[model samples]
Target: DIEMSTSTRGGLLKGLGRKLAGESLFMTTYVCKSATGMITFTPEAPGRILAFDLEAGQSLICQKDAFMAAQEGVSLEMHFRKRLGAGLFGGEGFILQKITGPGLVFMEIAGDVREYDLAEGEVMRVDPGHIALYEPTVDYDIAAVKGLKNVLFAGEGLFLATLKGPGKVWLQSMPLNNLAAAIRRYIPSKG
Candidate 1:
């Protein structure tokens, strides 16, 4: 047997912050009345689900709506981009989801996952939508793609998200936005 109820872990302000960070305001909690019990979670979209066990004070910054589930000790908060360029053209906008942990956290990646570890001062340029997660040590910003021909005919868009790192980063090959746009093309228009 099990009992369940709504949980607002961090109170009103945190709940409000979660809402701004693209998560639900209320979280559900389950209590097991029997000697043993279990629970399961699934991704909201067609994607891969990955889990991380973080030590106290460790944190990960993730793309909006990436959070799936986490243990009770994990904290979710809104992360703001301090750079105007990042805020305006970074693709993820000004606000992102930041999860801090002393426990396990699960995230949903829109498609296949790729992991990279960057040595100090190394940089990687990526399409903004493909960004999945990164350590706080990463310096994130946006830069315009160089060369007129590349910008006009490369089909890679104008701006690229630049990540300078001394830590690990994760990217997803199929972004949800790209998938939605692809599907939208086939939907019949309402006359």
Candidate 2:
């Protein structure tokens, strides 16, 4: 007896949190009464799907809208950066999604994906939008790109994201915001 129902998964507060994190308020759940059952999931955009099996007490912080799905026992919560600089210029804004585990999770990364394992105290600076996911052990911050010419004309924007670590990081070659900006010029305007 398989049953399906849709509602705000963690009640109203959690649903509201999900909404603030740029996801739909209600979630659909499927129950399997028999011994085994199968289900499929897909991303909303053309991208690669990555699966993670998380241990109890583990957590992964991801870009907003990157979450695809997760199994039971996983919790999706809001993550906020304490620094005003990160909130103002981090590309992802302040509200990111934090998925905690004891179950499997799926994330969608736009375009090609690259992985990096940073040793302790190692740092990698990146265009903020390219950041897809990272382990909680990594320190995330934003640095103002030095030099007036580079900041104004280099086209990398005012601030670059700084990931200092001893943890893994995943970056996407194409972020949806970049893709939209690229084609925006070709779009017809009312004017």
Candidate 3:
């Protein structure tokens, strides 16, 4: 039952009044400035992405695309990459699409979000899609490590995209893929 104060941007501010919890299965909302279009994450709310709009009146349940917004004078793009050895080798093992944001962005997940400050001359390895937002000044590149024996026997896959930063990074505790997997486990198995 976390609450966020409304913005002072001066418009008809109102809560659409929809109960979007466990019963509803997948919907959440946050306050955003219609003028600035900037929204922040909340703790009580899930850390996964949810649908939102600046112009729409009624609350809507939309797909992944609905959460994207263009702000901070930068364009948003979705980048997808595939992982070869996922669960079997403690990997995500699927194509993950991440939203590249260069502004004040908001994303909702299933648990509390965490922020890490990458020190100067230091770098960190993160799951490709877990990167919520980062400083535009950081450098990024996809690197592939070669080791045939490791891939075949040790199960250590050889490729990963490395992001080096001297900036802030946000990661969501709950990934969308994990959420989907949870739902699948509860559904009646067809086969």
Backbone atom clashes (below 3 Å) for every candidate? 0, 0, 8
Ranking by TM-score: 1, 2, 3
lDDT of 1 by residue, 63-111 (tens): 8899998888999999999999888987789999999989999999998
Better of 1 and 2 by lDDT: 1
Query: What are the runs in model 3 whose C-alpha is more than 4 Å off?
Result: 1-45, 48-105, 145-158
Residue pairs clashing, model 1: none
lDDT of each prediction vs. the true structure?
0.92, 0.91, 0.41
**For model 1, what is the C-alpha lDDT against the true structure?**
0.92
Q: Clashing pairs in model 2? A: none
Candidate number that wins on lDDT, 1 or 3 = 1
**Candidate maximizing lDDT:** 1
- RMSD in order of candidates: 1.2, 1.7, 11.6
Worst 10 residues of 1 by lDDT: 1-10
Q: Tens digit of lDDT per residue, candidate 3, span 1-191? A: 33344332222221111111111222333545454564444434345453323232211221132243333322223222233343122233222223333344444545445677777767776554454444434444445545777557653345544656676555556556666776788999777
Query: What is the Cα-based TM-score of model 3?
Result: 0.44
